[model samples]
Target: KKMIHAGAGVVDYDYRGEVGVVLFNHGTEDFEVAAGDRVAQLVLEQISMAPCVEVEALEDTARGAGGFGSTGVEATPAKRARAEAAAGGAAMGAASAAERTPHVAGEERAAAAGGAEVA
Candidate 1:
């Protein structure tokens, strides 16, 4: 078995021949394990196998149309200033989520608030 650590308490396995145990640290503090230490014990067993076939289909969703950074990034100074003004005028209380909700869920409201045509 090939063992790889993705994170604390998380391990990936590529089992081939013999099985092995992976001991992981779940806590923030570091710990140690010595050789021959009992990380885990295993028993060998025989199993029967059979051939099988599987099929799958692509899925869809409303948000599927958008992808990473679909929204504008690195806003220009003017756009930043306009967004700040709109946010302050609406008293969004320093919460970006509050300002972004309408943009994401209500195009009309977001466009009206930002003095732009809703596309």
Candidate 2:
């Protein structure tokens, strides 16, 4: 099938005009609907009213704010880095060469590395 979808929308009780179904085709291939062919079907059902109750705020759940595979998305290298940063590691940005220590022995080691006497 190129594209066949079905959904329900609210129909008011006082409506008098005919309810039209909007069908669309947004696939790579073309979909043909010949005459007398079944293109779509509509299922009618009674919908009940759900009274809204007011309160300060809704209680939080275990899946609060998580959506669309947020719980399933694996931590990539970049994501891991970002999570580490968000967990207070962001302050440890790229260490500069001056701030890095490469196993320095002492003054003698520094002099030997520089090929000069330690004054």
Candidate 3:
């Protein structure tokens, strides 16, 4: 059973202040935390920022500007199996680090992921 709802905490690089953690209790009973009690774990990771460039127009694609569920795909067992098969039995067609490519869209991307055709 889940008693607490803890989300990822992000501390900016240039913020000089006390780090605070927000914990949400999802249980009916009351929860208590004493001094020096371990409520969560923190891991420091380095992130990189890429330069942003302005473009006049974005590339045209079949699924252009389509967000989640824009392709009208249902998460069915049979469809999932087909998707897995198309991805060489890989889970969610996730590519290895070396084979990672930029976000693909439109028919090609869907076909590669074994997703349903987008209009």
Candidate 4:
């Protein structure tokens, strides 16, 4: 019989002998494994290999050498500035949600925008 732990354990691919698993219980209470329990699974796959080649220079393109969230990224300073200005010009009084229903969702910002009111 194989002994496989519930937590940190390893079974390397090079092992050719009969295997045993150690059942471990790293829990707050007692753990049990009954008959016909699917305690473990096995997977077989093929590992691909490729030879490395040396090159003199790597070709460059638009947004060259960019990786890790830097690709196609934009700062959009103008849009950010307009949003900040519109948000900054709003009234900051403590009004209840029921009392502000007539103003609608975007009514306050639309009223503050001079001519962008809806409904």
Candidate 5:
């Protein structure tokens, strides 16, 4: 499994030391690392710094106080239909399912093929 320290993946512009990656072995098998191996990738992302103001209280919403997994595990038929519509009604297979998901990148290209890489 891939593991990253908090804020460690993001290297500041002034950081000069050698970047290090940490990996943990949770399986029963032993993993080996050679002299040079492609384990992790560096993805440069533009950071946007915005000013923050603290509010006394947050406004109420329809789903207020509902935390993670509060909406239930299964998606409703209406939700599935919305997802399929968002994917241009291509959510008929595994590849299209990935395309319908919001977090997967290059979804259209993956849908054109057969499936998308899980991780």
Candidate 6:
């Protein structure tokens, strides 16, 4: 399948008849999908039907009642900032680790070569 922009794409095996498109905006800017733009295509194959089961009442949980800023959208800004900071820190750590790896490898090679001078 092709991506309209750089978002996610999904395929549903349970859905039948007409196919549907599911896209998410993972970037900062909003994305649009135009009509007749070939969001997705599906080739019809063998069809099988199954009996559907319906649930009347289901069990509930304490957090089940929470939805849409129920925990306070005010906290979201701080949470996102902290998460971004953590991600940036992790990326930096990975870069530093990569930088040191070559040095460590060079040292090992030098020791292996009868203590020959590196560089």
Leading candidate by lDDT:
3
Sort by TM-score, top down from the best: 3, 5, 2, 4, 1, 6
TM-score of 1: 0.25
For candidate 4, lDDT tens digit of each residue in 1-119?
24345443555667788865566755556667788887766556665577889999989875688877765354233343355457773233223221333334555534433334434
Candidate 5, overall lDDT?
0.60
The collision pairs in model 6 are none
Model 6 residue 35 CA deviation in Å: 0.8
Residues 81-104, candidate 6: write the lDDT tens digits. Answer: 345456664333333333433434
Scored by CA lDDT, what does every candidate get? 0.49, 0.53, 0.64, 0.51, 0.60, 0.49
lDDT of 2 by residue, 41-112 (tens): 767778778898899988998678989886566553335445655786644433321122233334533332
Per-prediction TM-score to the true structure, in the order listed: 0.25, 0.37, 0.57, 0.30, 0.45, 0.23
User: In candidate 5, what residue range of length 10 has the lowest lDDT sum?
Assistant: 110-119
- By lDDT rank, best first, the candidates go 3, 5, 2, 4, 1, 6
Better lDDT candidate (2, 6): 2
What lDDT score goes with residue 40 in model 1? Answer: 60
Query: Clash totals for all models, in order?
Result: 0, 0, 0, 7, 0, 0
Better of 5 and 6 by lDDT: 5
For residues 1-119, write the lDDT of model 5, one tens digit per residue. Answer: 43322234578977999988776666667777787977677888887788999999999986689998876685643466456668777436555455445453554435433444432
Please give, for residues 1-56, the per-residue lDDT of candidate 1 as tens digits: 22423233322244556545556565666666689765564544565466766759
Query: Once superposed on the true structure, which residue ranges of model 2 sit more than 4 Å away at CA?
Result: 1-14, 25-38, 73-119
Q: Which stretches of candidate 4 lie over 4 Å from their true place?
A: 1-30, 33-37, 61-63, 72-119
lDDT (10s digit) by residue, model 3, range 1-119: 65987777899989899987789998999988899988888899998898999999999887789988886664434455466687667454433211332344444444554454433
The best candidate in terms of TM-score: 3
> Candidate 5: where is the Cα deviation over 4 Å?
1-16, 26-30, 73-78, 82-119
lDDT of 4 at 28: 59
Better of 3 and 5 by lDDT: 3
